[model samples]
Target: MPSNTDISKLKELYESLDRLKESGEDVVAEIRKEINNIELQYLKENLFPEMMKTLSRKISWLRCSVDMNLQFNGEKQLDYSFCKSGSTVFIRDKYECNCPNEDILEESEMDSNNLEIITSTSNQTDAHDTPKRSKTYTLRVEFPNGKVFQGNVVSDTYVAVIKEINPEKVDSVGLSHAGVAVVSQTLDSKYAKYQKPIGGGWYVMTNSSTKAKGFDLKTISDELELELKISLVPLNNSEEAIPIMGISESERHRIRVTFLDGRTICPMKVLEALVEVVKYAGVDRVRELGINCCADNLILKNPAPRYKKLCKPVGNGWLCNTCSDTITKFNQITEISQKLNLGIKVELV
Candidate 1:
């Protein structure tokens, strides 16, 4: 790797660990947690589907939408609940945001108490000047533990409270004003540019006094249960998505995508290249990890027998479960092969 050493959430993460260590929490526990997070058998290292499953609390990451209430100043903003769905979602700041409302006029505890609707009117001579946006974003984050907290994210430039998180335990994930952007996949390096998703998601709240009030998620109200669901993509982040079309597969010939690291990646995994603005190296072109520098480079195997156990034999290579969709053709080998081919290849290590 041009850059890669150890996994550390950030300087703040280490500081949190120090705090936890002072409290008698084993630091080794934190290290092991990171390893497990990175080593999880993802859909070809595709963090989106699994993330969707974890956030949505569903078996399959295929559903279209979830039940969520988007209230503005106290009234529902959208005509219907969030009906749009995607592979991933983002809760970040964007300059050209057509996303409903960028600024928050006012925010109160999720209640029907006294509320007001405020709009801006420009009565100045210079019409080129944009109107003043809201100053504060009252952020009320509810948890599965029947507990809710109130806070705010600055309108234009702001950071709530950033803290470290265990990637393995996303169910207990919550939102706070703290500025930590996302839950990283590693605790080895502090640089977030190389974070698992390449970009962060969780806003790590680090105020020592800001204790979580309610108990951990236990019995969630049926009405609030849907609020926990997360779609495959956030409506805002979908704009940059690359379309994966005309996917073809077969037993005699196949296609799939793979990273330069030789790790298998699902279809959407290709879109991840957008994070670094790099051209995706299809599976067929990428050699296994350590091909040029390792002594095992020349070695080859007859995986015809061993590989079948892991994936269905297709075209010239075995298909990964993530890339192979046997949705309709269970018995047809060619159909299965064609369906499984992701226009990628894998050189076994």
Candidate 2:
């Protein structure tokens, strides 16, 4: 039989083990908290915008969940019906697909906790803390380069939505061109659809909504006579800066383009050219082009082939040849006919 001292020592050892286990658990909980912080920062920095999630409000770590869904052959279906269904559902973790179709799709986790994932949603809630309710829409476009960009659509107004659509089957788009339209549908299905010039820019809206059904302006015209309000939404990265392609913003607002010399312009052509330059040479090159502001000024001043400037004096101002001609047109300065004779009398007063 063990002595009293041995029993006491055994009890002390058990207490020590208990303390160690508690300490180990505390350390694990602390590490988990740090990991959550890192994950939240990464989502805020990269995932939210890329995924097209409305981030008007702040998300709570305890209350937030990472809702996700699976799409097979372009149709969304439920993987686990137990998961919540709502646009504003807080997904505790990312989605996982362990079904036989795993080879068709990929699976990933949002957190170490492995929380349940949402498959689909019919409604949206304020993910952010903002009081205003926002709806989520999708904007799909097939680019001229055979590339397709589909994501969340932002912008409450139709004009803003059109601007958000990316370029399609073309290099550039411009609003300043003779035939440019930022309308809701196709152009010619009606009475030879014409472009109407509006104050900020030109729009191709119809009196009836029937013409706005199909994506094509002309085809939509054949169906509906909807009232459309097209306008020049600022473009930074497409051809002629016109609506050759569509662009969309989160809200219907204007984009301001600024030059290096603090000069701002909203011309559709210039915006298109700027976008083309960026596409070919890259965005960094665009910044370098802005740095070369003098070159742009030269292009503006010389709008003709072999355009040249002649120096001339006007009323207290030095005008170029073009300005000089306009000022002296009425007061014709024919020639200087001051003839001085060799023996001319010198009149001294």
**Predicted candidate 2 versus true structure: per-residue lDDT over 1-349, tens digit per residue:** 2223333443454445455656776655654554455445545643455446453344343342232332222133323211222232222222454455333212222321222223223234557745553332333333344544333321223233334342221112212112223342233344224433222332443232211311343222112332222222233222231222212221111213343345443332222323322333333322332322112321132322111212122222212122221112111111000121112111100
TM-score of 1: 0.21
CA lDDT, every model vs. true structure:
0.27, 0.29
Off by over 4 Å in 2: 1-46, 49-264, 273-349
Give the alpha carbon lDDT tens digit for every residue of 41-156 in model 1. Answer: 22223334534669666635564433232212223332212212342221222233244421211111111122122212224436587766433223233334544433332111
TM-scores of the candidates are: 0.21, 0.18
